[model samples]
Target: MPQYKLIYFKTTGVSEFVRYLFSYADQDFEDVRHDITTWSKFKPETPYGVLPILEIDGKTYHQSLAIGRYLAKEFNLTGSNTLEDLEIDSMVDTINDYRILFSQYLWETNEDTRAKQKEQLVQEKIPFYLTRFENRVKANGGYFFGAKLTWADLFFVSLKPYVDFTIGFDTLKNHVALAEHAKKINAIPNIKKWLDTRPTECCIQEFLDAKHKD
Candidate 1:
């Protein structure tokens, strides 16, 4: 067995799914959570000054999705074939796009600008993605690819809490399939255990709260 160490911010952002992957595989790894104060010291040691690095037997790997894909393949969370893998990768990329968009609202300092962006994201972008995701779930019989669970499902469900907090509403309310899909993933034994054990507060929510307080 390879030694594994995952280093990321305390926030879920990109590392959460990798953590989920580990949990799903019932693998033991050192989860190192860093914060802003410590990141500067840690940054120079990492490639590209970016994080969610995975150290496997002392060699470092960067990029969250790349690490995720490797782990997915290793753990059989990846789809069975190439086409299915492509589709799953596409969906994961789509969710990453959504996360990036939501970060704009989370970081924007101007109230009016932030409000406008938030409205557009909620009223237009989110629904568009949610509907598409819902349809995919419906098509796949509750999972993202086939009958079994895939990393795409884990990726989606792992990022959901931050997305919901940033949207400030129940974005899945109108999407029954998506809601049920989330429920199904949440009920998975490993995922449920992780959810119950992890930190309740999300990073973006904490950032927003602190910004308001300031």
Candidate 2:
């Protein structure tokens, strides 16, 4: 196996998917996390000056989803064929769309605007996305795409904490299938091990607290 190094912030954030992909494959990797205070010092050395860069052997690659797709393909987590790959990619992209929506609400500069956006996110966006995902999970017999686990499952599992923190509630509570799907993924031996030992800080909370004070 080639050497894998992932550089991102101390929080789960975008890099969490990459971590989960590795964990699911039982592949060892170097997870390099940078605290906010020290990021500037390390920023210039990054190719795109961004978090969530993956280094294979010695070459670095940028873009979170791009890295995820590559790793999914590498580990056979994508799917067995082209059509399945398309479904998996579509689900991943849809999840990422919600991620961007949450980011906007989390980091909004205007208090009123943030408040409004948060309300919409919690009331409208969360339900819309989670309900659809819940249906998908139920339809797939607990997984997102097929009879077995895929990168889409890992991606959704990695988003649970952020979803809860941003919505200020257990968004999965009313969605039994989705909740069970998350539980099932988390129960996977390797993914469970990673989750048990990973950092405990709630990055979403810290991010909001910092933004609120500014």
**Using alpha carbons, what is the TM-score of model 2?**
0.93
lDDT string, candidate 2, 1-214, tens digits:
7999998887877679899999889899998877656676889998878778899999999999999999999998888899989999999999999888877876787889988998888789989998999888888888888878889889888977876776578888998888888889999999999999988764455545666777
Candidate 2 local accuracy as lDDT?
A: 0.85
User: Which pairs of residues have clashing backbones in candidate 2?
Assistant: none
Clashes of 2: 0
Give one digit per residue, the lDDT tens place, for model 1 in 98-200. Answer: 7889878888889999989988997899988888888888888888778679999999888876777777887788988888888988888987888889765
TM-score for predicted model 1 compared with the true structure: 0.91
Candidate 1 Cα misplacement greater than 4 A, ranges: 201-214
**Residue 142 of candidate 2: its Cα lDDT?**
87
Q: Ten-residue segment with the worst summed lDDT in candidate 1?
A: 199-208
Give the lDDT of residue 64 in candidate 2.
94
